[model samples]
Target: MSDQTSMISARGLRKSFVQRSRKGPGIEFEAVRGIDVDVRRGVAFGFLGPNGAGKSSTMRMICCVSPVSGGELRIFGLDPATHGPEIRSRIGVCPQEDTLDNELNVWENLYVYGRYFGLPRDVVRDRIDELLDFVQLTEKAQAKVDDLSGGMKRRLTIARSLINKPEILILDEPTTGLDPQARHVIWDRLFRLKQQGVTLVLTTHYMDEAEQLADRLVVMDKGVIVAEGSPRELIEQYSTREVAEIRFGVGENEALAPKVEDLAERVEVLPDRLLLYTDDGERALQDVLGRGLRPETTLVRRATLEDVFLRLTGRSLAD
Candidate 1:
């Protein structure tokens, strides 16, 4: 896409960390190798990867918290190296770790944070009320941070991030430790933000979260981008329509791989189960049964972004 239409753009972007060796000279650890990324305005974009996959490094550079080691990087069509303050003023960030002051009440936390951005007291107060209501934390506005539940704290953090009315919102693992219900709540709020024309850039390891929030995403592995596309597009390009999960007895799955390899288009042998990738998982399961192999359990499900990740990286997303 053209630069004029892209809110964030990168070409051959790279980040490295200098690590000192115990017995030798320092070594450079490449956290983000050469990669290109483009985030259009008013769209939710994601960086998906497992631990130590350069997702966080890329995000740091984007946020201007970490300097780029090499290559081109731009936010709002301006160079981060020179326009860090200008860019930061227009973006809001919800970090992975909760940084709220435990001694302060929820509303106070938001009010204080807004003050840091040089907002007027009346404006900050008004915005705090609106944000607390938006995140469904209106009832907890006067509650101390220590009294809030995990989900409530997360909601407060999201609300605080919006105090500035930023054009772009950057979330790092927004729902990392929340329960399913809590995660869905956060997702709904984020969906609303996107509908209101806020550009969202997030980093996540959860395949479902990426699929649910991102219109387009890039899958990163070992400091490099392995694939980039929408959830459905990546799944269609890298995996089959369906996946057949067959679980045998412990230690029995490995031996059965060869016998059932020809039944599906592709076979993935895990420690406890075998995944058969094919157009029709029910048909594949029938073929396996016809071959006289009785599995302990069988499940047929549609392909997911997790399946595409496995196909491209030959490793599970959780790994």
Candidate 2:
């Protein structure tokens, strides 16, 4: 089997939403500028960006929820514009916000969604029971959605999306409001899905989340892509193998920013701390100390996806 027959392929995708003017001149907003992406079967792909950077918009197009204005988007080699319903039938979607029915219980949510997809009653019933167990929500099957916790609701929503046993699963902001333990629960299940060779595409403003799940990813900024690669590759190419963050006691990070700009391969100074990027963090720290630069606090760590993100874009991912 050749690689060109990938599960998802997009080329030069462009999307702009028109804004109607009430008074003065209003203009159109191009949420997604021209971009291309591909995802093969049995791999997890991610879109990582700040808010309004077009991650969700791109996901919508892939799921056939929102149409693109120009360029190409194909799911399973089927054009989203011409084969939306057919494409949607093969994919499951979890929106950024919970869209679960407040009227339905946890199990009923999955059953009802399956039935809406025209699945046979027995099939829907069987899938619901299985999915409830898969999501670890068996105990809450009969509980009302309003009575469930935030993490429980998120899991239920995800379980609901899986009723059809779809070929592709698209998740937007999958763990937005969950605590650490809850997030781990969701991550564990997602990892199990990956082991089963489920093709997953997810959008997240969290850099750590992307690093955790994405086999390959694209980072978007200002409605355009800035970088695309596997987490380790992007970090190695765009940033250093290690980074040191130093916080000054008296002056702002900018006060010493210029002095240490050339100390590392790359430097970014914010209000709180200044980042020093270098292939060898220990050597960089020694040089800083040798230069008589004293910081109130210092932390040296391995270069991560967040470091690469901050280096490419001026803004933080969570911001």
Candidate 3:
């Protein structure tokens, strides 16, 4: 889509930082190399990569918290440099860390954040109740922030971010430390927000989370975007239909890799298992056994976003 139609647009966007070195003059470290991006209105766009892959830097620029070092960027058709305050007012940010004040209660946390947006007490109080209920934190509204569970704190943070009823919501590792159940609750809330026509932008380490939440995503590595597509498009482009996982005991995977290498389209020998990429995992396993090789255990599964990342980056997404 053209820049006019896109909610967020970038052309050769870049960000860099000056690093002070002990030996000599400070060096320049480019966190986000020049890249192009477009985030359409009301769609969930995700930035994904391993640690220090420019995802955070890009998000910072999008949120108008960090100035661009080079290239052009526009949020809501306004340059962040000139309209930083306006852009910030139109968007909500949920950072990776829980920034809630432990001294405040759950309701108080949202109350204070709304007031920061210059909202009137009556409006802020009303919005606080709506947000708390939206994030399923209404029952815990009177409880101390420090006493809330990790998931509750995360939900409260999300509620606080929405105090101004922003059109765009940016989340950084939204469910980093939450359990599966908690993560699902967070996902449900986010899904509802998206349904309400809020544009969702996020960065995540969990491949499954990306699959569930992102309509389109980009994979960045070493300060550049390496891949961009829907999760299924990415998997289809980078991986096979199925993956056959075979464990030949702890140290035997590498040694036995060659024996099954020709049985599938490709073979990846991890330290603990051999992943055979092929269209038919069952046939590949039978081929292994036909060769008189008996694996300690075997599992056949469909190719996923993680497999695509492994193929593109030569490592797990979390690594």
Among these predicted structures, which one has the highest lDDT? 1
Off by over 4 Å in 2: 1-4, 24-26
> Model 2, 34-123: lDDT tens per residue?
998989898899899999999988998999989889898889999888999898888988888999989988777888799878899998
lDDT of 3 at 120: 93
Model 1 off-target regions past 4 Å? 1-4, 21-23
- lDDT order, best first, reads 1, 3, 2
How do the predictions measure up, each by TM-score?
Answer: 0.97, 0.96, 0.96
Q: Number of backbone collisions per candidate, in order?
A: 0, 0, 0
**lDDT to native, each model:** 0.93, 0.88, 0.91
- Flag the better candidate by TM-score, 1 or 3: 1
Q: Per-prediction RMSD in angstroms?
A: 1.6, 1.7, 1.8
Residue lDDT tens for model 3, 2-73: 123688999999999999989999999999999888998888998888889898899999999899999999
Q: What 10-residue stretch in candidate 3 is worst by lDDT?
A: 1-10
| lDDT for position 271 in model 2 | 78
Cα lDDT of model 1 by residue, 42-75, tens digit = 8899999998999888888888889999999999
Query: Candidate 3 — number of clashing residue pairs?
Result: 0
